[model samples]
Target: MARHLRAFLGADDATLARRLTAAGTVQAVLDAIRTRLSEPARDALVAELTAATGGLLEEDLDSILLSGLLGYHGLVDAARQTAAEQDMTNLVTLDHHLVRVTSEPVVEVLVDRQQAYELRLALTVTFTVQGLAATVRAGRLVHVRIGRCSADVSLSWAGQALVRHSDLVDAPLVIKLGSGVPVHEITDPADDPALARGTARVPGPRVAQPGS
Candidate 1:
């Protein structure tokens, strides 16, 4: 009975599409945005303390910025894991058939210190797996590359605007997906879109950093 249902569902493109759609596969990716991306963004903001901004206001600003990036990256990591899990489930349920999976994740990071400092990051990450199901089932290296990611970053202190980047999309994040290939990560400079284009925005007047 179960086999018959699976066969009936997978027998045609329209049936398969409907079955996949009803399974709410994309929703799994969305959930990962909240579960996985927060830590890196928050951690990045804390790392900004390397600059030692001094006064309370400066400290608040530093915290917001570093933490924001940390949380963003963390979320990206989680999303990658979730995507991989979804792919694995698809492979098992659908056999070795190839399928295209796509998800657009929109995340907003807001770190506020009352009236002292505030950091807001509106980010959109386009995650896609174009027929990697076959490679995955065959135990081969699969590249799960993010399509296009855009970020609108804004920072404000004492009711004043400091820095802002609207629709910054030069660097796109990519995750190498497969067994023994390391989970989704931005380790390589060539693979890290955020590092390749530039570091995420930190609160302050945009000044030239040494390597940025």
Candidate 2:
């Protein structure tokens, strides 16, 4: 389920909603069956679930969330860049801890050759990273690591049904850290001098830029 979700991260609004619904449906059935089984029987199904997901059920939650966050950032950067070139407003915010990101995309579409209306869309992805840790340098957060993660996703399109999920449900999942995974760099020291010194370790969550 995590593997499919990772692919859906970069998909269009409609496609994402469709896939999430499908995955959620499958997960519901699997969950019902597992709950009725004995403890040992339930435990044995772990291997089956792993096989069914091609091992993605056991994949690192940190890596999946990081990829999604990075992709989210890239989208925001692209949108802002385009807005700057076109002299338009781009309303996008990623929180300081990088745990939540919201984007409001406003585009003008012509109803005919003579009239047009602005179409506004919204998307938000929020994550709660359990046991999150941080590295601070020069008064700025520079790196992070995670123990586990759960997510909330919502996407809305003008004149269309809204899609939201507290977590992906295709199968019962336990999101945890992968062995030997390294801390992720959230900021580059070379990009900002303030991020280069005064190193300290701390605990926290992550994502955002000022005036953006």
Candidate 3:
């Protein structure tokens, strides 16, 4: 499952393995996914949304909100699919200490493949669920109320990934939702209209980011 997700996000397994204890693991993961995008894919995505909405949101704020909605859905879907593919019979307990990931992903298979990574099954893959909205400036924002989220997750696992999270090539124009952001913001790192069209930047990791 980890391998497939890395493939989906275009993350290099070797790099991830090496960074298992590094501070920049999350940033590195996001960059890997972000840098993979091509300009053309970004353009088409926005065009499709524009057509779907009958050009209702021609304004930048509206456009970004639309993008956030699309991006949020894509994130949730991919997370769910990835969660489903894993075999987690051995995931005995889901205590935080057993599965800590300050940045890098730790795929500690230990000597017990049968019981190792046992928490995968019991742990639900969650994202923002409701009370969600978006804001636009230089990029985008999927806003969550202070101390709250659409996913409504408890304080324990917010912002940090249960495992690994990364960006991809030919990906959407997303900005990092950096620490203390209080929302799932997918910003356009660069203000390129072409980014609006990258429909490939969705569930299952942006159409596999080219060499998926």
Candidate 4:
């Protein structure tokens, strides 16, 4: 009987409501069933009904009364709370990180040769913290703080690569170059005796110089 009751109550909302109405008025049907059962049997059946309904049954009702009242209420409030917490746990925020470089005269030749010339160059400098990560929209900045700058000089010029982040400012760079040689190098005059040491001035942005 409990199984049949559960099945009837589990029907779609419209079917359950129609069957409940056709059986007789809900209160009249429950009163008839309650009068037929003994007190202990009725109490035991109500306990079973309470358990079957997951504690949703009223304490005063017999099983038949509860069975008559059964109606689906959508999701349980506890289940909804758990689902909300799970969604919060699944949410995440992404972090942002990027690299950049900035400088003046976006493109410039720090050194140029007339006809054909070849010579070693050296760079000694300190870079501003801002300069290291500043955006580099165009061209490249080479540091020649250490080692020999050697290249062949000719109409068809050859260039040499400079060492970057080398602490040894006095180190010489050797390079081989040919005619019409063009080289771009960075140096801190405050660190180079030949450039006449003084407070170094930071250069601002400028249009690319002609011939650069």
* Best-matching candidate per TM-score: 2
CA shift of 178, model 3, Å? 8.6
lDDT string for model 2 (1-212, tens) is 44443343434434443443454522432343333544454333333322222211222334345444444443345344543454433333333334665545333222113212233445556676555443323222234444455577554554343455566432323334322122233322112323111111111112247876
Give candidate 4's error at residue 28 in angstroms. Answer: 7.3
RMSD of 4: 45.9
Off by over 4 Å in 2: 1-6, 9-98, 111-115, 158-161, 165-212
Candidate 2 lDDT at 108 equals 29
lDDT of 1 by residue, 1-212 (tens): 11111121122334323332344422332343333335454344333321111111111211122123222333344445556575442121111121111111111222232122222212222212122211232222244333333333332223332233344232333334445232232232213333212222223223468999
How well does each candidate superpose onto the true structure, as a TM-score? 0.23, 0.34, 0.18, 0.14
Error of 3 at 23 (Å): 33
Top lDDT: which candidate number? 2
Ranking by TM-score: 2, 1, 3, 4
Model 3 lowest lDDT segment of ten: 93-102
Pairs of residues at least 3 apart in sequence or in different chains that clash in candidate 2: 27-170, 97-206, 97-207, 98-206, 98-207, 99-206, 138-197
lDDT tens string, model 4, 1-212? 11222232233334423432343322232353434544554344333322322111112111221111111111122223434453321111112111111111111111111111111222222211111111111122111121221111110001221222222111232112212111122222212332221111112223468899
Would you list the C-alpha lDDT of every candidate in the order shown? 0.28, 0.38, 0.27, 0.22
> For model 2, how many clashes?
7
Residue-by-residue lDDT tens digits, candidate 3, 10-123? 224333333332434333323434534345633332233223221111223222333344444433443344345543111111111111111111211111112112111111
